[model samples]
Target: MDWQYENGRIYSTDENGELMCEATFIRKENGEMDIDHTYVNPVLRGQGVAAQMMEVVAEYFRKEQLKTTATCSYANIWLKRHEKLYPDILSEDTSDQAVACKIDGKH
Candidate 1:
């Protein structure tokens, strides 16, 4: 499996070039980026695909010196579990308002 990053999104692809999972980050009004969406193909579930994608997203955020709001439920859970790995990028405000706006097309 290989991970590709492009257009502010990360994609996991198999050797055959089939997509296994994907995660996207959207820039918010406050200049922080949100991990707004993530999907792992049902066939690829439980294979650590989402965890790998989250790692890539976290690394990208650190390298770019950007903050992150984990809106995706999986991402939120991952962040909580890996707080030490991303302390600086984790926002102090954990309110779901930003995520809600993004989902409702209000942001």
Candidate 2:
């Protein structure tokens, strides 16, 4: 699989040019990216590809000194599960409309 970032999305495509996985987000004016969608081709699921894709996006945020918020359920779960790894890049719970994701204290 090959990963590519364009416009405001991160995605991977298969050798035949089929999209295998993707994570999409909205760039908020507050410098926080709101992840709105995350998906992996059924063939690409269960292999941590989604997580890896998100990691790349998170790393970008880290380098750019940005933050991230998740409106997608899958993304929210992943970020909250790996809180410590992204504390600096993950946006804090500020908006009342944001989901209250829980941390498992594993990281």
Candidate 3:
């Protein structure tokens, strides 16, 4: 997937411009980023697309020398799963309660 980056989002769209996947974050007052949303189109689910998206997000943070926490459930879990590879990028306050999927309101 061809991901696109913006001020606070990393996402990809189909040829017709329909959203395929997305992860959104907000910059915190403490200078840490809080990942708040993640979405994958149904057609793209079960294909490891969400994991790929998180990898992109992780790489982006590493490249920018930023720290991050994840309020979005998937992101929170993913970060923990890959902590060894991104030790310095995860904030100490990285734990978050489970949240519904932002795009469809599914848990």
lDDT of 3 at 69: 88
- Best first by lDDT, ranked: 3, 1, 2
State the C-alpha lDDT per candidate: 0.78, 0.76, 0.89
Lowest summed-lDDT stretch of 10 residues in model 3?
98-107
Off by over 4 Å in 2: 94-107
Ranking 1 against 3 by TM-score, winner: 3
Residue 24 Cα positional deviation in candidate 1, in Å, after optimal superposition: 0.5
Best by TM-score: 3
lDDT winner between 1 and 3, please give it.
3
Quote the positional error of residue 107 for candidate 2 in Å: 30
TM-score for each predicted model, relative to the true structure: 0.81, 0.82, 0.90
Per-candidate clashes come to: 0, 0, 0
Candidate 1 vs candidate 2: the TM-score winner is 2
Candidate 1: deviation at residue 13, Å? 2.1
Model 1, runs deviating above 4 Å:
95-107
Local distance difference test, candidate 2: 0.76
Better of 1 and 2 by lDDT: 1
Best-performing candidate as measured by lDDT: 3
Q: Residue 53 in model 2: shift from native, Å? A: 1.3
Point out where model 3 deviates above 4 Å. Answer: 96-107
lDDT of 3 by residue, 1-107 (tens): 99999999999999999999999998999999988899899999999999999999999999999999887889988999999999989998875534445655333
